[model samples]
Target chain A: MWTFLVTEIMFFGGMFMAYIAYRHAYPLAFAAASQKLNIILGAINTTVLICSSMTMAMAVHSAALGKKNLLILFLIATLLLGGVFLGIKGVEYHDKWVHHEVPGPNFEFEGADAQHAALYFSLYFGLTGLHASHMIIGAVILIILIVKASKNQFSAHWYTPVEMFGLYWHFVDIVWIFLFPLLYLIDPRK
Target chain B: MSDHIVPVRVYWSVFITLLVMTVVTTSIAYIDLGPFNLLVAMTIAVFKATLVVLFFMHIKYSTNLTKAIVISGFVFLLVMVFFTMCDLLTRNITAPGR
Candidate 1:
């Protein structure tokens, strides 16, 4: 499982490299393009994800202490927070659609360096889209864990699921931690 | 980790640290620092991410093998990105003759 996650990190690392190159090479373009994204929404999403991370930590704590009910409550809290993050993300993506910021077809930016602007949107969609996919997977994993939890499949003695899930949840949170600034910060107009 | 629950205080501290990091990053974004801007922003982000991995993800309590694997993964990732970007960095603008 750890190896598999490392592989995923490598995948994202490739894109992050591309992001750095483009952002540095065309700083103005990337900034102008990036500024078009809704920072407010991004900030809010960051808050939501941070909250989710807290809940996930609590869930792991509950499992460690054999507090099944607390574990379930915190897990549900984490899940709801995951949903809230996705919900805000949806709104941002919708705004992009109306503004034609979703690259690959009729995307345009009214800023310095059109190509880099396009590149920004491309990265925006690409990174966030991948993150969103992970979130869905995380949610599914949680639902399963929740059900198993009811059956007492997890306890202080056997709770690898809780720990593993916490790891994944924290990972997702870390990704968004990076994403918040990369997508929302810096305006070329400045 | 053997059926021992980490305290609630740990969770609260993690939450507060994350929140503070978020604020710092956002504030830094509004300031202009030339090329250093991206560097500083990304550096702070890396710190925040590390915090999540260490505390929230319990990497601190994880086995040595797990830590080794994770670190190696990031090491290789950095290598891949760095080497690839080396070529990509020196494009048409900085030719020897030009």
Candidate 2:
């Protein structure tokens, strides 16, 4: 699990490097494009992700203590929170689509630096899309865990799956922890 | 492998700290601090990531080998970013005729 996580870090690390380089090249465009994002939705999603992480942690704790019912409950809570996050993300994506902010032929940005602003939106979609995909995978894994947990598969002596999945869930949360500030909170005063 | 079970209280504390830091970072973004705004935001983010890794991920209770593996992953990431930035930031100064 740790090995897999190391690879995941490197994978996301490459995109983060790209983000840093681009933002360095076009700070003004990045800031202007960032302001186009809805901060309220972003903040709420951040809160939801954090709450999910907490519930995921509790789910792991319940598994460790061999509390079968509590483990199932917390896992369901985590799953619901993940669903809410994806729902809000869908709303944000819809808003972007309506405004043609997606980085295809329909992309539009009313700014002097429209080209660089498009680049910003491209990275925005790339990063957040990758993160969202991970959450979707996580939600699938959570469903399986819930099924197994209901069968009393996890317990105090053997809860490795639950614990490992907890690591994955937390890693996803950590990605958003960085993404939130980078994508949505870029010099908002401008 | 022996497992360490973290108390519920610890998880709650870490969770609250992460939420509070999120709020703080978001609020700080609205206040222009020039270049320092990015620095401050990233600082808060790094702090929050550390909390998640150490507590929620149980790195704090893991074996020494696990600790080394995790830290090395991030260390290598930083190295990649650092060297790449070194090149990108100095391309103009190193070869102005390009």
TM-score of chain A of 2: 0.98
* Among all candidates shown, the one with the greatest TM-score: 2
**Best candidate, DockQ:** 2
| Residue A184, model 2: Cα distance from true site in angstroms | 0.6
Share of reference contacts found in each model: 0.72, 0.89
Q: Give the Å error, residue B68, model 2.
A: 0.3
TM-score of chain A of each: 0.94, 0.98
Candidate 2 at residue A102, lDDT? Answer: 88
Q: A26-94, model 1: which lDDT tens digit per residue?
A: 877887787787766787889899999999998988888889999999999999999998898898889
What is the TM-score of each predicted model, taking all chains together?
A: 0.92, 0.98
Candidates in order, interface RMSD in Å: 2.0, 1.0
List candidate 1 stretches off by more than 4 Å.
Answer: A187-190, B1-4, B91-98
Q: What tens digits encode model 2's per-residue C-alpha lDDT throughout A1-190?
A: 9999999999999999999999999999998899999998999999999999999999999888889999999999999999999999999999999999988899889987989999999999999999999999999999999999998888799999998899999999999999999999996555
Model 1 score (lDDT) = 0.82
